[model samples]
Target: MPSVPLHSSATPIVSAVLAFDVGGTDTKAGLVLSAAPGEVPEIVDIQRFRTALDAQRPGPVLVDFLDGLLRRYATEHPQLRIAAVGVTVPGLVDEQRGIGIYAANLGWRDYPFRAELESRMQLPVSFGHDVGAAGDAEVALGAGQGAENAMILVVGTGIAAALYIDGRRLRAGGYAGEVGHAMAPAPDGGLQIMEATGSAGAIGRRYLLAHPDFSGGAREVLTLAKAGDTVAQRIWAEAIAALAFSIAQAVAMIGISKVVIGGGLAEAGDELFEPLAKQIDQLLSFQPRPVLVKAMLGQNAGLIGSALKAQELLSAASSEPSTGALP
Candidate 1:
C-alpha cells in the first residue's frame, strides 16, 4: 500500500524508460530519462517497495502493486513521456507472448502481463525472465562485458543461469538456464539436488537444520569445516563439489570461456570461488578451462538489466511502424 511521490518539472519533455524488477519479496523500479549506449542509464529515480506476493491471489496483487508504482512515477514526471516499460519477473516466462507462464514463487500462471500493462499504462511493454534479464545486464555492462562466450550463475533463493554466446542471448523457451534444479552426483556418494546442496540458502539451511547449535551462513560452514566440524565440513565440501560438476558440464557443452557467479551464496568470495575453481580444474584436462569470477553487479543487476531492456524496447518501438496486433 506504499506510494511514490511525483515531482513537477518545467524542463522540456524528454523520452523516458521505466524498468521494474519484480521479486517475490521486493520490487525495484527505476526511471531512466536519458543516456547514451555504454553509459549508465541516467536514473531519474529508483525505488523499492515490499511485495505482497504471498497472498492467495498474487497475480492481481502484483498487478495492482505495479500499477500503483507506475501511477506514482507518472504523477511525479508528468512532463516526461515514457517510451517503454520493461518488467522482469521470476517464472517460466513467454517472452514473445509477454506472459508469465508459471512462477511458483508468485503463484501466477499464463498471465497476460504485457497486454494488461500496455492497456493500463498506454505504453510499449517488454517482458523478460528475471534471471535472464540480469544476465543480459551483466554481459552488456558488468562482469561478463566483452566476453564472447560466458555464463552468469546467480545462486539465491534458487539457482538460475544465463548464457551469452557470441553476443547473442540464449533463451531456450525460457527453460534454458535452470542449473540449480539439475540433479547432481552426490559428493557423499548419493544422488543430491543441486540447489539443495550447492545454493547458499540450501547450504546454510541444511547445516542449521542438522546442527541447530551452529549459527552462521555458508561461509561459516566453510570456516567450521576448516576448524574440523565434521558435518559442516562435509556439507561445505559437497556443495563445492556439486557446483564444480555443474560448471564443468556447462563448460563442455557451451565451450564457455568465462563463468560469473553471483547471488547471496556468492558472497562467500574465495571460500566459494577458489575451491570451486580447483574442483572444476581437476575434473577436465583437455576441455578449455573457464575463467571463474564473481559477479560485479550484485543486487542491482536485475534492476539494471530491466532498465536496459526497457531502453532497448524504447529504441525498437521508435523504429518499428506501429500497427494493430497481428493475429
Candidate 2:
C-alpha cells in the first residue's frame, strides 16, 4: 500500500500509534489511529519498503531506518501523539528484553532493538518475532479466533510455525516454532529438513533442478501440475506429503486441534489442503486429527499483530502512575 501523509486538513487528527513488521524481503509499517475509545483502531498510511540488508552493522542501520520513519510521521502530524511503537521481525527475538537474538538473513545478533528505538523516540516499544506476532493476531481475530489450541504454519519462501497450546502462546524464547528444520523424508530416500521438501521455495528449487529451462516459481509449478505435467505433479505431491507429515508430528506432540495454513503456497487452496488433510488422516492412528484451515488475515496479519502490541503498551502506560506529575 502507498504511504499517506499523517495530517490532512479535511481529516480530523486523533490519538495514534506506530507499528512495523520487518520481513526478509520487505518491511511494512502502519499508522493506527483510534477515533473512539471503544472503536477498533483505524490503520492508515500503510507503506512497504525494502528490508535493510546491512549485515555488518544491522543494528545501527535498522535503528536509523526506524528513527527516520518516526521523524517523518511526527513532522507530518504534529498534533498526533504516537503513544507507543511495536516492531515485529523474523528470527529469534527475546521479546521481554526487547532484543533481537539472531536473524540469519538480516545478520543481526543480540541486538538491543527496543532500547535503541525507545531511546531515540522516547516512546514505549514492544518487540516480537514476526511469525509469533502473526499467530497471535490469528488467534485473537483471524482464523484461529475460536480455537484454543491452534498451530499457524506459514509456508512461503520458507516454512515456519506459530504454536498455541491451551490458549497460551508457546514462544520458548523464540525457538518453539522452527518446524522448518524438522526432519522429513527426502526424494533420495534420506532425511532432510521439512522446509527443503515442503516450502514454496523448495518446490521451485526442486523443479528447477529437474527442468533448468522452466523459469517458473512454485505457483507456476502448481499450475503445471493441474495441467497434468508429471514432473510438476510429482513435486507438488511430495510437498503436500512432507507438509502433512510435519503437521501430523505436531499434532501427536501437542494435540493441536486446528492448523491454520498461510503464505504463498496456501494460495493453492484445496489443491494443497485436500491432499494434506487426507494424508494427515492416513498418518494418524490413535491421535485426533486437526482441522486444517487457511489464514484469514492474509498478508496483513503481522501488521495487525504489531498494532495490537502497541495498543497493549499504550494501555499499560495509561494505567501506570505518573512519575512527573505535580501532586
Candidate 3:
C-alpha cells in the first residue's frame, strides 16, 4: 500500500496556535487547530517565506516578514482566530525569556522575538530552539511517541540532539544539545575538531575536496562508494564510524531507549542508519542497544514542532482563569 498524504484542513480547535520555524535562509510558518495535550495535532495552514538571515538587520527583516504573514493569514482566514504563536529559531535561544541569544548566521544577539510577535498580534507567544523543537515533535508524534525516553539527534550542516526524559524536554540553559561541536580526536590525527571530520556536511566536503573529479555532496559520496571509489568509500566509512562513536557514547551515558535521527545527512536513509546501528552495536559492549530509526517527519520537522508548541501555549492561555491586565 502507498503512504497516505496528510492534507491540511481548517477544522477549528478550542484555541488555534500559529507556529514559525525560522532558519538561516528560509522561514516556515504554519497553524495548528483542534489541539490538545498528547493529541496527534494537524496543521491547518502551512507556508514558507524567504528569509535571508545572513544579512545585517535580520531581526527587523524577519519581523516585517512575520508581520506581513500574520496579517495575510488573518485576512485570508477571517474565521480562525490565532490564540497563540510559537517561533523556533536556530542558534542559542533563551526560550524561557523569549530571547534569541545568538544566531551566528542570522546576526542576532539577545533578540526579543516573543515580545515582538505578541505585541504585533496581541496574542500569547512561545519561543523554542529549532533542533529542540524538532526533537519535541518527534517525541510527540514521530519515532519516540510511545517511548519512555528518547534522544533525537539532528545531523545536518551541524549536529544537535534533544533529550526527552519522560514527557518533558530537558533544556539545560538552552544549550543541552551541541553534539556536533563535541571535540574528538581528529580523524586526520591533526588539531581539527570533531565536527570538521564527523558531520555529514564535513564528510561531503572532505570527499569532494579530496576528489575534485567526483561531484560533491552526501548523496554523491554514497554513490561514489557504491561505484567502488576507494577514497569515497573510506570517507563514508569514517563518517559513519564517527557518528556511531558519538551515538554509542550518548547511549551509554544517557540511557536513551530510542534514537531518531533527522537532517540533511540522514537523507541517506538505510545507507546511513543500518551502518550506524551496526557500528554502535559493535562499539557498545555493555550498554543496552537502543532502537535507531529515521525521523518520520522530513525537513519540515522543525516547523511542525513549532506549530505544536504554539498549540500548547494557545491551549494553556485559553484555559487559564481570567485576570485583569495590570494598569
- Candidate topping TM-score: 2
Residue-level lDDT tens digits of model 3 in 50-102: 87453677677677777778778777776677766778998888888888888
Q: After superposition, how far is residue 75 of candidate 3 from its true place, in Å?
A: 2.1
Q: What CA RMSD would you report for each candidate?
A: 6.0, 5.5, 6.8
Estimate the TM-score for candidate 2: 0.92
Mark the 10 consecutive residues where model 1 has the least summed lDDT: 318-327
Candidate 2 positional error at 30, Å: 1.3
Clashes of each: 2, 0, 1
Error of 3 at 121 (Å): 2.2
Q: lDDT by residue for model 1 over 1-327, one digit each (tens)?
A: 776557544667777778899987788888866666766566677888887674477667677778888888988987777777888999788787888888887898888888888777777777888889889888987899899889899987688899878777777777788888788887567776788888887788889989888788887887788799899878988888888988898888888889999998788788888889999998887988899888888887887787787777666656788854311
Off by over 4 Å in 1: 1-9, 12-14, 42-44, 54-56, 77-80, 222-230, 321-327
TM-score of each: 0.88, 0.92, 0.87
Candidate 2 lDDT, tens digit per residue, 1-327? 998978766655467778899987898988877544433456778889887778789988988888788788777777677777889999888888889999988889999999998888788788888988888888887898878889999999899999999898888877899999999988779999999989999999999999999888999999999999999999999999899989999998899889999999989999999999999999898987899999988888887778788788877767788633211
lDDT of candidate model 2 versus the reference: 0.87
Better by lDDT, candidate 3 or 1: 1
Model 2 RMSD to the real structure?
A: 5.5
lDDT of 1: 0.82
Q: What is the lDDT of residue 51 in candidate 2?
A: 79
Task: Tell me the TM-score of model 3.
Answer: 0.87
Candidate of highest lDDT: 2
